[model samples]
Target: MAMSRQDSRLRYRAVARLHAENIDQGFLPILGQDFLALLYQAIDESPDSALILAEEEGQVCGFIAGALDLKPVYRGLLRRWPALFLSLAPSLLIPTRLWRIIEIVRYSRKAGKGEAVESLPAAELLSVAVAPSCRGRGHAEALYIELARFFIERDQEAFKIVVGSELEHAHRFYRRMGAEPRAEIAVHGGTPSTAYVQQCADIHVSR
Candidate 1:
């Protein structure tokens, strides 16, 4: 659908609502309960994070979560003053904060083993979902385009996405977005996950 100023307010509201609902329902399934709190903090504190939602008649049709890595900043701070994150660790270990810690540790170990470089400043195209009734209406593409613009504005180096091995449709969609397969990480289940990367410079250079 062609989004216009006339639909902007309604669309914004739908985006906010869909964002909250998706965090509570959609993300929980994929990230697991162990990682939800970290996901929440990542979205809340990262200035580059955003939610792009498509709406029709005040109803949300689709949404995607975009997040940038704060690792660069964290690493710098730790290097300059080693005690900061260490001091903050006590509070982060409280029952409510432990989940994010667990998630970071788990992902850090995975990153160490995987070929995907964890040191670069990267953005994550975390999740995307379209309402069942709104499938095949181009809303998904619109949401992604909006997110691409947002990421470009931030001068991000690259955007990373992970897709389940069996989801051929999603794989094709990411390929259409110019994301190339970069790595594969084996999950607990027999199926491995595919990681895709699209560099901002590459996109601009192509255009």
Candidate 2:
């Protein structure tokens, strides 16, 4: 179903709840309260980040988190204020920058020769998930469509995403969306993940 921009608040809450619940699971067992607070802060402070949720009959069934690239800001903060990184050190070790390093390495190796890393477009599709009961109902696709529209409305030229090898279904879904495999990078403590890129100019959205 098509979603209205006015529903952003509801979507954000649902997405935040899903993210908190998932983190509570095996994804990042070490994420403590402080880390979660920091994460929320990051999202709240960034104009580029967004939380999107899918609902049916007034009940939230799935959600997706997306953001325009804001890494430069964080990186600058880390460099200028090393103490800040140190303050969040414990949390970083578990599910922040340090943890992401592992994934990057794994993906790099899988990317093989001739593949080069490119800067992601300003827009990115970060994370997406559906409730167990809502599986196979196209909620994920619907959410993606919403994200694309969001970017398009902002005049973004492209969008990108990273999908782990373990998420076979996601890989297929993205392929169907006309995303091309761009690079492979190792995810620390896990297998390689493939990076995919899709140009909005090439995407044909049907009404």
Candidate 3:
């Protein structure tokens, strides 16, 4: 149990680091201990959340975050950690990209231009990223394989990823992984984006 707990933290830290520098981080930097605390709540406190990390030479190179049921997990986070979020309020004043935390949440809540969230009881791929230096090494695929297995074992059955349209590389990656566009949505500042869903059958990852 202790080892499992430590591994979770390690994975969280790795993903957090990658997210901070993600191409879309411009939308929501989420920097600092406050945001890290929020991540802990999301990934650790949320029973339906899953994270998988890829390592190289004992250091994290990439990771992916997913949720079996995001609405409940988010609701629980807000209810159980009001104080933590409240404490993070003042950080909004910082010039970093933290301010978008509010905007991003609002932007994502609006149903995409052509898709509805009710189409399926599918797991969500919250985020996935790999260090620039580690790209093209198959780390991303490994992480997704782990995530696929995680979802399958839990009976989540299907997974979806909401991402920006400008991220052409990532979109292509998901397409190659067998994701199909389900809807288009508006993001922070009314920018266009899309949501893609992949069934467990569509993706094949070696066990």
Q: What is the lDDT of residue 134 in candidate 1?
A: 85
- TM-score of the candidate numbered 3? 0.76
Alpha-carbon deviation at 189 in model 1, angstroms: 7.1
TM agreement with the true structure for every prediction: 0.59, 0.63, 0.76
Q: Write the per-residue lDDT of candidate 2 for residues 36-83, one digit (tens) a residue.
A: 334434553466766566777888788766667556435433453554
Report lDDT (Cα) of residue 36, candidate 1: 33
Off by over 4 Å in 1: 1-27, 30-45, 70-105, 108-114, 118-121, 187-191, 201-207
Comparing 1 and 3 by lDDT, which wins?
3
lDDT, candidate 1, 1-207, per-residue tens: 866655654554454444455444322333333233234334534565776666787676888777775454334334534344553455455754466445544663455344554543367786787876787787777777777777889887678887778778888888876888878765433347887887755542222
The true-versus-predicted C-alpha distance at residue 69 of model 1, in Å, is: 2.3
What's the alpha carbon RMSD for model 1?
8.7
What ranking of all candidate models by TM-score puts the best one first?
3, 2, 1
| Model 1 lDDT, residue 46, Cα | 51
CA shift at 98, candidate 1, in angstroms?
Answer: 9.7
Candidates in descending lDDT order: 3, 2, 1
Output the worst ten-in-a-row residue range by lDDT, candidate 1: 26-35
Using TM-score as the measure, the top candidate is 3
Clash statistics: count for each candidate: 0, 13, 2
